[model samples]
Target: MNGCLTDWPGFCRQLQYTGERRLLVLSGEESWAQQQAQALLALSAATSTLWLGDAPAGQPHSPTGKYHTALGREYQHLVFNAFSGLHPDALGASAGALTAGGVLLLLCPPLKLWPGFADPDLRRYVALPEQAAGLTSRFITRFIRIQQADRHVLSWQQGTPFPTLSLPAGTLWQGQQDNRGCLNPQQRHALAVMLHSARTHTPVVLTADRGRGKSSLLGRLAARLLRAGKRIVLTAPNPGAAAQAQAHCPVPLPFIAPDTLLKAPPPADLVLVDEAAAIPVPMLLTLARRHCCVFASTEHGYEGTGLGFALKFQPALAALHPHWRKLHMNMPARWSSTDPLEPLLFRLLALNASPPAPPPAGELNIQWISRQQLLNNDTLLLQVFGLLILAHYQTRPGDLRQLLDAPGMSLAVVFRQRTPVAAALLQREGALEQTLADAIWRGQRRPRGHLLPQSLAFHGGQAQACQFSYERIMRIVVHPDSQKTGIGSQLVHWLKHNTQADFLGTSFGASPDLLAFWHHNRFKLVRTGLAADGVSGLPAAMMLWPLTTAAQTVLPVWQGSFAADLQDEGRNMPGDLPHPVPRVNEQQDRQRAHDLAFYHRDWHADRPALRRFVHRQPPCPSLDEQQQRLLQAALIPGADPVVLAREFGHAGQKSVISALRRIMQCYF
Candidate 1:
């Protein structure tokens, strides 16, 4: 287009002829990149094109379709500018929108210097405003290496000649077109599997990368099932994802959100779950147990990777239905298998990333590693980041930038040989000036990256806590295979003993098992957020471990305030109830048994005249083990009465109910 690369038309033609997607990297000055993109657009034969980032005026540009909005959309060609800093989520998402024989033209700085260049997105992860100016990331360096290894990627500099296009050897179309309108063999196979599942009342799992037509296959299967006189229900994390599958079905099909479906199910012959990974594992398990369901999810998606779903939910599904079948769609519905952009996106986002194989069975070595050291070692960085990704649901490209560039952040790892089996991310907090501390205490200022101090001063009413230095353990991850082996606890112990901070603290979505783990580490609950977290739909609990005498002086005040707040909130509820006891392990269970035995003995002697005591009562502290078991079974949601009877050696549901009533009478 700029007269330095005249083979552009020929290269585009070859890509279309082979039905392959190719990446055209226009790397040079901003003007050069824009000029090449404009020229390519004029010469190419793409029918539908979408421009991302800042592009030439009068072009079909997507204003809001940067990273996450590209799903459920399709295009024949795309031109993405990385001048504003490359967003990995945007790049991965837009690449999936390209049709077969399309071209993804990327505009960026020269490949060799791109990694070291200042990225604008680094500002979002900078610990301090001063650190934003001199930040760099190893993620970009690794991304450049991946691009260099891909031969199909065409790079254009200031004055280089356009390279000749070389196509990979393979027939793009693998099988004859079926009457069901499937474009490829993979889609055909998926359709057949869905049909069989509907007829046999078996659950099926469908997994594929984006743009694999899995959504469309689901729609066709729904239509076929409906025509066969079967009622079908479609669901997803959001209504829009479910709509993708429903759009292809001719007949009306009801779509429900995953949570609603789990809470109250309607009559249906089969249930189709789209984007299964985005739905919580608990909800998916409920659907699997209650209905014959077909689950469809992208292998690695911008919404989030399905690796966790495969690791945690698949076993549960198998336990519920051993005959369930799995189908994988390997062929891309919109592009060729050899598309260089696919693998590049995968590596850049660490979407398909898995932790390093567990260190050869032995004792793990735990130590703190500097950010510079991690940047210097590519293998170690990948292993550490991969474990972090697996440990949390919200890990993203921005986190990688922080891991490398944040000045106040540090990493600790437990290694087996050279492989990282467990890791923790810690951030320094507090040490705020008097002015800033006063503002935080008054809820006038809330700064980024200082979660522990700000939360304690404003929410927990511990303004003095903000004056002392602290370290917040942001995340602690142990390899799935190494869990329950004390790796996580050992990591926390190492941090507490090694650091000079006045306190060690953490905040996370509350759950029984997680609370037990923190309690066992000697961390006491100090505060709970008023609102539930959007992701887990559960309240967040903040726990603290005092490291100095100054911190110990303020601990009792915070604890008393937290306890009062918990009681007040419970009283405000409709039932004027008390909060449930935190579920800890065998020691607490035994204590509860002892307390309940005392309550049973005193109930008749100390019986109160007012019924108010019965209505506002907390769990019976003196119940026996059997009574506690019966109460738990009756009160917990989804607990089957028949199963409880069998498990607890009761005669039947009648005996189980009788025991539960007797326990309730003692409390009343």
Candidate 2:
């Protein structure tokens, strides 16, 4: 192949003739870059092509698709325009979409200054205007260096000759006759495992990097099972993920949402969960218990960290099904094993990254590192950020920008020698101006990034809390291997002792285990959102720890208000609502129980009693377990008497009413 701008057509022809994938790097003026891309697209005999980022006039293209949408799609050619700034995620995702005999063309500014150029995506990193310019990320710099060093990657400049093509030998792997539609040997093995597991009703887990054909394997397995008269239920975090498998299968496969499957499980011989790591572990556990299940997840996915899933979920699976089997697919289904972009993307996004090794069974050295220091140290940054990615279910590329550029954010990490075993990201909160604080309290204004202050003022009804300076623990993660070893507590204690903030607080989706962890750290639940979180489908809980007299003064008010709201909202809950905080004292519990019984029977007469019950705590003897159950059911704003009766082993609603009356007599 000739090496020049005009030679792109010849290069494309050679790539197509060989039936092998190649990456074309075009660097120069934007206009010339587009022209080169156009020439390649015209010459390449691709059935389908996608152009990401802006395209020249008369060019058919789609805007850059977010990395999460990469599943269930393939293309013969992909063009990524990096002039406006390179989106690491889009680059990673678009690379995976190319079929075995395809090409990925990346158009960027001159490679020398590409890293330092102002990126449109940088706007997401900084809050203040001054931090925008002269803010170059090292990740981009490293990416450019990698591109320059690789000889296999074809690079083209404006007036310079295009490098001669060094096409690798061998046609794209088309699977064996018995494994049609499977692109490679690894995928064929995975298909066999899945089919065998389905037939024997043995639980199986499929793990692979992105584009390993795990989803497609599931689809093929489902089709085979369905033909044999076995019902297959397919699910994922969303319908789009499930659709990936459905699209690949020749026959229609019954699909259900993750939550729906958990609530009312349909009859099936096998339940296949695609992107299983993205779905909550609790839901996955429920499905595993009810049906023979198969889970497919990317080993290091853009959607969620499979490392975290393996750490947390694998143990539960072991306990649930002792005979369960796991299969790992290593070969790429869409591209060759030697593709340079794979390693580049993994390092850039820390997709396959792991946290530092655990300390040698000893005390950890904790340190508070400034954001600038973290950014300057590439190895440390990866270790810290990788730990965070493994800890959270929804870490995205935007979070990396925030970590490097966001103001009022601080990082602390516990090191075992040179390895970071645990880390925390803290954000300064509260300290709002009086006007802004009052407006927030009155629901007239909302601010970005001030989660604690805004949530307290508006949601908890603590108007003055916005004025008090506080520290919000944004995220804290201990290495899975080192958890329950007190490293997390040590980090928290270090923050409290070192910082002069008036208080400390944190919030997260409420779960029994998570709530207990916060409570163990001495944080009191101050508020709980009525609506379940859109992502986790669980209610959010906010907890606070007072460190000063001023903070102490407001803590009780917030706690009391939260309790009252919980009493009112629990009734509408579908099932039993876990108490957000510790239960009240015996005296308060008795008074609350009495008021709830009266309110349940006749609210008009007991309205005044309810008011007194919330406002004051009086002296009284402790109530029995039955009395406590009555109080919980009756105080729940819309609790059904019949449901309460059944829950408490009563004969009927009449029996529940009689039991409530007996409990109320002592209070009266």
Candidate 3:
């Protein structure tokens, strides 16, 4: 006991000398762990310590483990009281907040109990009928295994003395001398590229790993632009993230949310977007199209992957701005390159995960990979996460936790020569009883997880839509090199045939290309949300493929009622929303559609069909400018002839009808 107490301070001094980050996990009773956490902080030479998680009352100022942004600040030590609850996102966010020579103290129960311990976060993605207790401990099991494998990790068991920690007084690392407006050569070169792009009015894509001073460099750029009296507008997923770049600026930089900025662009000589990957692609395009912009996103961190930015958004960006410049910062800004925590965090979270090598030229085979199998195999796990990151930049650490533990989540990967070429994440949903389905349909109860059924019941005007089971595709991704080769479509087809569900459905932020792809695969158009999705800043779309006879029979009724509801909210509708599907094989319906599309034949007779067809198909690209606007604006059921004429620059109501008729003829 005397020797252990003496060696505790010795470990702290070693950390200070080496400037290395360390992790100390206290696994015991809550009170014991809390006391241990405080004791370590007091013994260490840490000047600033941020305690995260629930403080045992009286310490009201102690930081709770909220999903706060840690970009603009640094702390010498951070105490994570996992005894209260483990927050994956909170942990990931604060990972970089600790500077070198700091310790991340985690307080939790013993390793054996951890796997079966019902974590608070397990309920986040688990929908109804899947309780947290029902979820496997696969995520926690892997987490424990990884930590146990790390010899450096300090572990403490309940009723047991603290594990003796030995520290080596390692040599310190030094970064390069300060260059023009940058701390290192990489930042300096990146700044020069930005300057050139600014002068040439070329768009810029700036990316770097976390702690690489990407935000710091942007701050320097912002300061320079401000000194020149240039108009600068800053934006990010949220104001908190933008503050990191603003920290380097001499003046307070105006920050706007990405969604708001897209809706109303401010005047600016240069627009700098921090954490660009968090914003949806549609909004990013709008910003890029309207201004000379620099989009800076992190390559990897606790937050998520910016590698997906390269795989998904870059191609679209190239199409719009061919002259866009790319810059990457290579060196760490605050911590040493030899920081152990950096690599450990990457390994623990799979933040540095990379996809499989180029697929061999062989037949593709689709197979389901279980969560337990993924937990057991590191290579399989990395490849799965890598593909997820490549497909969705918003793939965060929390998602990794959910992937291994959340109930009803299944993965299907298309393999070629034993390497993943395409992958799909599917979640079982719906299967609601009639009583609950009725309540949902009537707007009395709104449950989580069963997104498709809930949308169908509430928005699609059919309570029976919730009676059937559905396997919903959460995400689908094909290798960047293998994309556009029908691999994605093939995977979807395979899922549809192999899955034993009443229907195979999907919900996503709708885009023209995406909608077309699903439509081509025989999925019918359903509901397009009335409000823009918080994540994508685009309207959500629901589409379904019926596998059973009952699903087919009920779908037709859903189409009519949902179509009526959508037309009621047409003023706020997105351009991507095609009109609802018109009932097929009805003579009156065909006549109405023909009359409305060809020449606004009889406004009274074709009102229903016209409304359905107009909202059913996407905007006509082949139509001339005036004709397209005319079709877009005035052809709806309740469109006012005079208002339509003045708004769309059309001749008159009669002329509007005549033009719509010609337009409908092409479409019909």
Span of 10 residues, lowest total lDDT, candidate 3: 598-607
Best by lDDT: 3
lDDT of 3 by residue, 185-300 (tens): 78888988897888788999988877777777788888888888888888887777877688888886888887787788888899998888766666777888898999988776
| Best-first order by TM-score | 3, 1, 2
User: Which pairs of residues clash in candidate 1, taking residues 3 or more apart in a chain or in different chains?
Assistant: 100-334, 595-621, 595-622, 596-621, 596-622, 596-623, 597-622
| Model 3 regions more than 4 Å off | 1-10, 60-65, 128-130, 175-181, 228-233, 237-239, 250-267, 280-283, 301-313, 531-538, 563-668
Candidate 2 per-residue C-alpha lDDT over 1-668 given as tens digits, one digit per residue, 9 for 90 to 100: 23343555555555544445666789888889998888778766567887887889988766664545555567788888877556665676667667655777888888777766776666555433455588766556656665667665678887787676654655544433354577777777778877888778789988987767888888888888888999889998777777768987899998899888878888888999998887776678788899999988877655654344676567788899988999998877665565556676666566655676776686678988876676577688778888988666667654665676566778888988768999989888888889877666655666666788887766554557788887888899999898888888888888878877888889888877777788877887777676666445568888888888988887876676556555544423222334444233435334434534543333222222343463454433567876776755665555677988888888997887777666655556
Tell me each candidate's TM-score: 0.76, 0.75, 0.80
**Decreasing lDDT order of the candidates:** 3, 1, 2
Report the poorest 10 consecutive residues by lDDT, candidate 2. Answer: 600-609
Which candidate leads in TM-score?
3
Decide which is better by lDDT, 1 or 3. Answer: 3
Q: Compared to the true structure, candidate 3 yields what TM-score?
A: 0.80
TM-score of model number 2: 0.75
Clash pairs (backbone) in predicted model 3: 578-615, 579-615, 579-616, 597-661, 597-664, 598-661, 598-662, 599-661
Q: Per-residue lDDT tens digits of candidate 1, residues 131-232?
A: 567656666776677777877677877667655566555564442346896878778878887898788999999988898888878888988989989989
Q: What is the lDDT of candidate 1?
A: 0.72
